[model samples]
Every structure is written in structure tokens, then in C-alpha cells.
Target: MKKRALLIIAGLFLLTSFPVTGGSAKVTQPPSQKEEIIYHIFQRSFFDSDGDGHGDLIGIRQKLDYLQQLGVTAILLTPLYESVYYHNYFATDFYKIDPRYGTMQDYLRLIKELHRRGMKFYMDMETQYVASDHIWFRDSYKNPQSRYSDYIIYTDKENTKPLQIVAGISDFKGYDGVTRKLVMVNLDNKEVQAYNYQLFKFWMDPNHDGKFDDGVDGFRLDHMMDNLDNLNRLPHLFTTFWNPLLGKLRNINPKIKIVAEQANWASFGMDYLKDTKIDRVFAFRLAFAIRNFNKAELIKVVDSTLIQTPKGKQQIVFIENHDMPRFSDAVKADPGKLKVGCALNLLIGGIPSIYYGQELGMQGSRQNFGITDANDIPDRQAFEWYKSDTGRGMAYWYKNGPWWQHNNNDVPNDGISLEEEQNNPQSLWNFYRTMIRLRKNNPVLIGGAYKNLINNNDHVFSFLRYEWGKKVLVAVNLSGDKQDVVIAMQSAKQIKNLYGIQPVISENNLAVSLPAYGVAVWAVK
Candidate 1:
């Protein structure tokens, strides 16, 4: 299996894309603020700065030009607060910046640079859980008379042992091999609520100047939920916990957009939108259906999602993220299928979030390497910065760890690094660039309503993204064999080729012949 992958890697990958129109097309008005193409970065795995082997705020600041060139309007970073864990989930302190990732000054500078380029920055925050070393845990634990008592959930009347959220959960073993106890915070506590508001407000305007230039544009609520751990300890939190806190945050910064990672990935997230103040949620169903490559499943999920989502709210679409296996792994490294995934990511009608390193076909899977956090290290490896796998900007933070032996996918000369793909016009990275530019250039693709286009072929997925007086047809062949699909349409002869691939007009209907794993787009009146 490894030999076959190496052989495929040697050839590199080829994808066809042409400039909109024959060349130098007419300019159109840009899309609204609602159409932000978010580039989600696993901050630890992104580019390194200061030769620290760890990705830092200054490092991200240095790559602003590269991110802007890729056409992403905003960046969504993983939690940056102080945490012993490598992923920064079990934060020890919500107010302090992770020293390894850089200082608070570096964070402000990164946000400043992002806003200067007309880009937005979204900070990831999860406050429901904390490390055992946190002040609230340390000061309150086993101390019922302590002022910070009731800040953490304790089963005993004496307030000794904090309620364990994860089953059989003990001290969390960090990727660095250090163990720290994890605690579930008491969300129902009023003081905790007040502290949460203060923390959120502090990030909104860190300088306290009220100029808002240095603050993050919004936040990604990590593992947001109404019920705490389904233990029935904290229920109806949307009204009591979230809405009140979020409403207060909005009062401080009305424009602060919050996207929730709903606790249940299988849910449609209408409840989160309807019951809470969240602006958006990840469309996991659509993502799963897209990966499955089944026409019926895609249509079913998309249709249901579109119909159910309320006005003024949005669904974030992507093939994979920090928690799941890379899309390349899902398709077993098929270059064509990878391109298909990219096309759908931008061509659909939703806020598309391109995960960092996904553009270069980065590969990893969720490993069952025991209960320790190391199991997630496989999917969260360093971003491939060089084809040779060694460079100044390489964020290979896991190199010296025990998993170093298991950084099995980080092969030299595999042609999966940004260095190899950035310059190659036919590389997957360039394909991502082309698709992003395509979506940004076309107004209909941004904030457009989605409609499934009926096609005879099961291997092909067709949809129309339409707006007032502007309509675009996108057809993708998700299979390994060429496919011919007929779509019902009238006056289709005037179809304009907005992309390299297009179909012929048979009578009054549209006839599209897509090569194996090919994607095409056209403007149909």
C-alpha cells in the first residue's frame, strides 16, 4: 500500500482550471460580509516563527500575505489560551496567551495585521472545562469554605471531587507526557457567568481603547452545548447560560459573530440557531454526505439543511476539520476525488471553511492509540512546509516525541508539501486557489440559494446556486469513470463558460459529460 502511494506521489497531480471567461473577464460587485471564506488553522500545525518549532501568533502574522493571496477572507484559529495540552482545549487560564504559541503582544499584532488586510480573525474558546491547575479548580477544590467554591461541579455536599465529564476521566496526559487533572466547570454558577462575560469582553477590545482594531472579529465556540456532558446536571443552558452571556457579549460588540461547534455532529443545528444567539454552526451532515459521494445523500442532506436553516443564519461547510480524518485519507489519496471535494467546498451555498494543510492533500486519520490525547496527534501533525520535510518555517513540534516514529505520513519528496504545490499550476494547492478565486469572483456563488439540479447519472452531483437575476450551474462527477448527465433546462443555449469545463445544449436541455472526477461550472440564465 505504501509503495502504491509513493508511485502516485512521484507523478504529482494534475487538475484543469481556466481563468473566468476566455481571460480578463468583466468585474462584478463583490459579495456581502455574510460570504466570508474562512480558512480554519490548527494553530499548532501552521507555519513556525522565531525557529521555535512551534507555530505562533507572529508566525501567522508573517503568513498574512499568503493567506490573503489564497482568497480566504477570515481565519479561524484553534484555542490560543493557556493550556498544558497541545491542542489547547483544557485551558488553565482563559485570560492568558499560551506562552509557547507567543505572548499577548504577538496576538494583538496578528489581529492588527489581519484587519489591516480587510480580513477577520476568529478566536476559538471553550470554557466549559478547565485543567486541574486552574485557579478556580485549585482554589476551590476540596475547600467548601473557599470563596471560589461552587465554581466547579462537585458531587459531594462537602465539594471535594469535581464531576468527571469524560468517562473514567483522571488527570489528562498531555502530548508532552505530563499529566494534569481536568475539571468540568459549573456553568450554572453566576460568578462563573460574570467571569465568562469579562473574559469575552476583554478579548473583544484588548487595548480597552474601544477602537476595536486590535480585537478578534469573532469567536468559534468549541464544543458548545445546551446540556453539560448529558449528565443532566446542566440543562436548558441555551436560555440560562448561553443566551444571557452571548447577549451580554453582543451588547459589548454587536458585530461579533459566533460560530458554534454543536456538541452533536449528527444534528442539523436548527436548535442551536433557534434557541441560542449563535450565528452559525458546522454542517456536519452535508460534510458527511459530500464525502460519501452519493447523489441522493447529498441532495437529501443539502435540501433538508437549506430548508431548515433560518434567515440571517448560516451553515459552515467543509470536508474535514481538526477533529476528523483528512479528506485525502477518506478518499484513499485519489487526486481526482480530492479535486471534486474542493469544487464542492466553494461551489456550494454556505460559508466554506478550508482547513489548513487540506489544500495540499495532507493526510492523517484518528488513531486509537489509547485514551491519552496522543491519539489525536496523528490528525494534528505539523503542516507540510517542504517537499524534503525540513525547512526554517516547518512547525514540526512533534519531531522529538514518541510519535516522531509514527509521523509516518511525513515522508520526504512525497510532493504533498506547500513548497511543492504552491508553484505547480496543476497541483492541488493551485486547484484550491483557483476554486477560491472562482467563488470570490462570482456574486451568485456567494450568499446564493441552493437548488439540486436533476441529473440522470448517479455518479454526478449537480446544483444551481442562484441569486436575484444571477444563476450559476455546477456539476461534479464524483466517480472514477466518465459520466454523462442530462439536466432539465430551458433557453440553455446561452450558457456561458465561467470555468474551463462546460456542457453542450441538446435541444432545450443541458448535456454535461464530465471526465472521471471532473467538475464544471456555467452561468445559465
Candidate 2:
């Protein structure tokens, strides 16, 4: 069955941007902030000034030029709170920045520099649990008579939970949610809900004003709807936690964006995420779309997702992210297919999220963070800084030891490095550059309604984006053999070439012959 969906753009101005007129002459104003890109800074491999081998905020500041060169306008840094382990999922404290990553002064400098460039900054917050080393935990553990003991939920009758592990690392030594050995407040507990609320309040209260600081505009919600035994299913948990958080944040900053980490399609949270209050949703479905699909098959997935997503919220699009296998690893490390996948991500709806090293074609299947053998951190190799030299000076900033090793052979020094792509116009870097520029040039592509063009085609996939009476068609050929596709358009003003396989002026029907792994973009006049 075909689903019809409509996306109404809000708080967005017309593309026919007018110049400011002061008295009589036209005056130039600052460019649109909406056009800026948001780069998710993993911070693990960003830069290391201290030579301690982990990326820190200072290192991130040093690499701002690289991000700016890529035309990125914002950086979504992972949690910087003090934690005992890597990834920092388990927070030891919410009030201060981790010393290993750098002092608060470094973070302030990063914000200052980014703001100077007219860019935005967002920090990740994990409201799940505190590490065993946290002051709250210490206080609760050391003093049984202290009032802080109420922060942790313990059981005198029975033990329902076991030892806790942060991000799959069992040695984290955290308060288990299921077992009561070290009591961690159960998310499902109604009595502890207030405590969780206070935790969030404490995390956002920078001035200790007991109020959230409005300077932070957005958040990268980590493991948002996971590990909820008593909280029930995804939809229920979202209503239980997300709605409240959204309400609280909106009461302060109405423009804040909430990006949740829940990826389940069948879950009700998927439907709830489309709420108008939630501005954007992370496109988790793309990770499952690997070498298993042809161009035609990929289109169906995109169509289904577009239909399911709420019209008001944007879908965060991407080909590869930190948690998933690298795009290069999907096509059996085929660089050509990687370009096609990335192109599709850029052309699709929502904000495009580029993972670290994806631009340079880093390769890995999965990773073992030295815990379980089957599940591991794959493709998370250190960045190769030199174009020809062996990795010598590349350093990471976090003092905590990394769970995984650099597994891939591709580095900055190799021929397949980012440096090579930047110089070569035909390289994948230019392809991304062109794609981003195309998205910006065509307002219809950004704020338009997405409609599937070809439903049952075997080798070709196509769709049309419509807005402001403008329509743009995007198609991709993922099959190994060449195939012709019949395009559907309402008018005779169809023009293809800016992002498509060939130039065509279709009067109702357009025929396109697509090569394997080829992507095309067309516009309607």
C-alpha cells in the first residue's frame, strides 16, 4: 500500500531570500544558520595536545579548521562529564568536566571559537546511571545514615539486579539496576523518578541557579529508551521520560532539538518521536541497509521511513555512525559503493551525520572492546595524520584507556587517505562537497515533500522532493547490470544533471539508463 505524507516547514523562511535594505541600498546579511551542518564529535580521536593519546576538547578546538573546511557549522560532542571508563556513558559527576579531556576553560574556549565562526555546540547527556566512583555513589555507600542514600534504590527482601556494565564493558563496576548489590535507582520506580529529574536538573544547571542554562541549544540523548525493564516498551518509556524532558527543556528554550538514540521500528517510540515537540529523530534504520540492498530495494526502505516519520520532525540521516559498521565494510570494503551510500544520505531528508573516518573510507566489520568475542568495536581505528609517514604523532586525549585497537589499514598517510581526497576533485570528498552544495541550492530538496517515484523497479530507485512549487527527483542504480527506468513527472519542465545519471527533459515520462552504484539528481522546471 502506498502511504501519503505531508511535511509542513515551520520557522523556515522562503528561499527567495531578500537582501536587507537600509534606507535605499540593498545590504547583505549573515547567511542562514539552518544551512550549517552539525558534526558529531566522538572526541576519542579528535586531537591530543598533551600527547596522552586521547582526544580532548582542546584537541577538538585545534581541529575546528578541518571541520570548518568541510563546511560544518556545529559539533555534537559526546558526554564530557567525569567517568571512570571510555565512552563516558556512566557519569561520575554531572557538575564538572573530566580533567583528562581538559578543564572547563577548554570547553569554554571551544564554545567561544565555534560561536566566533557562527557555529553551534551541543553536549551529550546520559541520564541513566552514575559510575561507581561518583561522589553520590561514594556518599551513599560510605554513609548508610546519610540522606544521600535515598538516591540509590536498594532491596531488603530480594535481589532483582546484577552487576552493571557501562557500554558492554563488564569491568565498569557500576551500581546495577537489576541487582541490588550496589543500588542504582530503577528508572521504572515511580518514587525515584523525582531523583532522576533532579539528576537532569543538576546536569544542566551550570550556574547552580537551580535552573537550566539556555546556552545549550540541543542534546544527543544516549541509550534513551534502552534497558528499561519496569519502564515497559519503547513507546511507554518515551512518554514516561521523553515527554517530560521535552516539556522541561521547551519551557526554557523553545528551539531546543532532542535527538533520541532509540532505533526500533516496531516500537511505539518511533511513532511518538514524530511528535511536534521533538524536532528531530536519529535515522537508525540506515545502519541495517548495508551491501544487502540494490538501488531499488534501498528506495523502498527510504519510502517506508519517510511515511512513518512525523511530518514536523526531521530525520537525522547518515550512512555510518560510531555504533555501526563502517560504510566501507558494508560493500566488502568497496570504495565505490561507499560513495553511493553517502550520496544518498546527503540527498535524503533530515540532517546528515558523518561518522569519523567515513570520509577517508575506514574499514572494519565489528569490534571486540576486549569483553565478548563476537561483539566488538569495529572500524574505530585512529586517524592517520600523515599522508605518507607511519602513524607516529597521532595522539588521543582522554586519560582513560581505549577499549579497542585501531583495526583498519587505511590511515591519513595512505593513498586512500583524507588528504588525497581533498586534493582530488573526483575524489569522494568532492562528491560530498557537491552533494552538500546541491542540497543548499535547492530549497525544495530540504523542505519539500518526499514521494516515491519507482515502487517495484528491480535495478533502479527514484523519488521526488517537492516544496515551494519546486520538485526535484533523485534516483540511484545499485545493481551490477545496467537497467533503464521509467520516470514519472507531472510536467514537461523536468531537468536532470545536477545530481542525476544523465540530463533529460521529460514531458510526462523520462527514461534513464543507470550504471551500477550510480546516483542521479533531477529538478523540475
Against the true structure, what is each candidate's TM-score?
0.92, 0.80
lDDT of 1 at 53: 83
For candidate 1, what is the lDDT? 0.82
For candidate 1, write residues 1-525 as lDDT tens digits.
122321222113221122222221122333453458999998887988988889888889988888888889999999999988889898888998999889988898888888888899999999999998888888988789888888888889787778888565856777777788888988899989999988999999998888889998899998888887788888778989999999988988899999999989899899998989999999999899889997777877887776578877888999979999889999998999899999988888778999998888999887765668887777888888788988887888878767777674579989898888889999999999889878877877987777665555667777777665577889898799988777656555489898857677765567778899988899886
lDDT of 2 by residue, 323-369 (tens): 66778777876655776777777776657777766776767677444
